[model samples]
Target: MKKVFSQIISLVMAVLVLASTVSWTVDKHLCMGRVMDISFFAHAEDCGMESAIATLDSEDYQNPCCEDESFTIEGQDHLKLTWSDLDLDHQVFLVAFAQSYIDLFVPLEKLPVPNEKYPPPILIRDIHVLDQVFLI
Candidate 1:
């Protein structure tokens, strides 16, 4: 009886550890940059042959704290992302939002990693973040 109870506790502890490990992978798909606003969302599709994906547009949300008139991807700058743009509907917006989500949340060891070959301020995934500021 003692051995059995010990084994059960061990199994339960293993299961909890696995559960917590997985939970750690779930984090925010955050972005920061010149965009007026940024947001993220996701959806999965069954096309039979290929999966369909979508993302939100950054322009749809409120503007950023500020903006620079000139923005370029090559200058090695980071940009915030939002879930919408102008009057465009959700479908169109989702196309980009999906990619952003993957780039923001998924891990390098997991599916859907970022394409770092392209540029700077690259996507950050499975991140732990806190919003704190210090004033001097």
Candidate 2:
């Protein structure tokens, strides 16, 4: 009876520990939220080949044809993308593979100025940005 009781207690403790660990991992691994407003006008980013070579989160979301994938950004600080994420550390840049592209980074003059008239926002299919690793 004593041996069985001890085994049961040990098993319970182990289960609790595992459960807690899993809970923590799930909480920390993904950013969970909802699109609260239609005014949430922002850029949608997709992970390219470079991302695939590095991690799995993108694989979870990106299609096999590498078509348009759903990548969401939470707030302005956290950008959730369809890419490996490099263990959730490398922040990826959304780049579109296109032809006849000359520049990836736009100049300041092209950006909307305080008093200057500007045309509609450009839909750049080919974006180029390097992943930035964060210290967690």
Candidate 3:
């Protein structure tokens, strides 16, 4: 269960990093103050008003009733970090932390058993029979 939980947490963190470093755009088309279409990562389709206005005489050209708007969200562009980028103190701390973390999982030395080489004493008589103690 702990292993599964750690895996899930790692996956979530990876996704979070990916999302922070990714960029996207949102395109919207509005006609007469009402949203006509909304799209992602692509241009929004224009309403029929644009073509109708284009066909009119150039001299009488005026702003079309429809409008197109776009919003671009830029994500982190510099994600490459190197060891040299860290300060000496930070590097030392990181090294110490890593060493300690590794040592945390190191198996402890096996303890010596006190009587591993000793054999059990030989039974000469039935001690349970000699004693009056009996289980009910």
The lDDT leader among the candidates is: 3
Candidate 1: tens digits of C-alpha lDDT, residues 1-136:
9999999999999887565544121112222432333222222222221111123344345433333232222221333445554457776677789888888965667566478577666656533333344445
Best by TM-score: 3
lDDT measured at residue 92 in model 2 versus the true structure, 0 to 100:
29
What tens-digit string does per-residue lDDT give for candidate 3 at 1-136?
A: 9999999999999999998988989999999999999999999998888787778888677765778899989999999999999999999999999999999998979977899999989999978889977888
lDDT for model 3: 0.91
The digit string of per-residue lDDT tens for model 2 on 1-136 reads 9999999999999887565544121111111233222222343343344466457654546434333323333323344545665443333223323322436554566656675666777856533333454557
Task: Please give the ranking of all candidate structures by TM-score, highest first, separated by commas.
Answer: 3, 1, 2
List the candidates' TM-scores in order.
Answer: 0.19, 0.19, 0.64
> Which segments of model 2 are wrong by more than 4 Å?
24-136
Full-model lDDT, candidate 2: 0.45
Candidate lDDT values, in order? 0.46, 0.45, 0.91
Two-way TM-score contest, 1 vs 2, winner? 1
Q: What's the lDDT for residue 52 in model 2? A: 64
| Candidates 1 and 3, the one with greater lDDT | 3
